[model samples]
Target: MTQQELQQLVEQISLEYFKRPFRHRVVINHRFKTTGGRYHLADHHLEFNPAFLTAELRTDLIGIVKHELTHYHLHLLHRGYRHQDRDFKVLLQQVGGSRFALDVGNRRPQAKKFHYICTNCGQQYHRVKRIDTRRYRCGVCSGILKITTKM
Candidate 1:
């Protein structure tokens, strides 16, 4: 949907769900990579991921809109608007907003792990960051450590 259509939908949802009129702008942010939407506390504007704008993901779009709107309304009303707040939780459930942002492959890519083994003792050690095999030795046997593999 176009940005204008999304704005109308957001305004409509605000009125229907929270009984409040949304006066701020809604933006379809193509730059959004990890989040379904974002609610700007400074401007009271809402930004949504453009990836969820398809017909197949309309429900997800609505849920994201509602989730941001929940933050919008609660913050404007000076109620607890944070995720950890009781008021935010209650209002979000009352409005049927999604509790979490829609996942958009936000999982962090795992860093390569370094696997090491002792030459004499066979004790293994796994670490995320690379370690110096020359300086570090096996903890159990104090034997020379060598690179086993990487994952």
Candidate 2:
């Protein structure tokens, strides 16, 4: 969806769910990497991740909008607006807002990769988790293995 559509959606959700009018602006934030949306305290503006604008992610987008709106409305009312607050949790659950953003694809960071080599057969192996050098041996010749590098 476009930025204009996102703004309209936020306005509609605020009125429908929070029973309040959204006077601040809402924009699609292209730089958001891990978060679904953000509610700025200084400017009272709402920012949504542009990646969740697809048709398949429509429900997720609405959930994110509700989550941000929860923050927006709570903060404006001088109530507990933080995630750890009881009012925030109660209102979020009441509005059916999602706590965590959906990781649609392989967007999360990869684990550390370790490279191992054998002394006898010179066989190389790459693994995501670290392996014990004393317990683990090379598969080819059962030779002693040592970590070569970590990436």
Candidate 3:
């Protein structure tokens, strides 16, 4: 969906659910990861990840909108707006918003990948950091571990 459509949807959801207008801006942010949407406290703006715009993710998109809207409305009303607060939890549950944004397809870039193999069981291990084989043994059969290559 376009930015304009997102803005309209935010406004519509705000009015329909909160019975209040969304006077702030809503934009599509490509940099968002882990979270489908975010509510900016300083500017009272809403941001949504563009990855959830596909037709297959329409349900997720609405849930994300509701989740962020809960934050926005609660903050605007000077209520408990943080995720840990009771007001936030109650409203989120009432609105059926997603508790956690489902990881769509975004992945954090790994600096380096390490491949490890066990001598006995041949069990493989993939890690982002190098490990000393002597210090750590394979959990399968207490076998000696060796670093194979960078994957």
CA lDDT, every prediction?
Answer: 0.88, 0.92, 0.89
What lDDT would candidate 3 get against the real structure? 0.89
**lDDT of each residue in 74-134, candidate 1, tens digit only:** 8998999999999989988888888876676746676659988899989988788999888
Best by the lDDT measure = 2
lDDT score for residue 121 of model 3: 96
Q: Is candidate 2 or candidate 3 better by TM-score?
A: 3
lDDT of 2: 0.92
Which residue pairs in model 3 clash with each other?
none
lDDT (Cα, 0-100) at 55 in candidate 2: 95
Q: Write the per-residue lDDT of candidate 2 for residues 1-151, one digit (tens) a residue.
A: 8888888988999899999999989888777887899999999999988889999999999999999999999999999999999999999999999999998663666675999999999999988899999999989999999999988
Q: Is candidate 1 or candidate 3 better by lDDT?
A: 3
lDDT of 3 by residue, 52-79 (tens): 9888998899899999999998998899
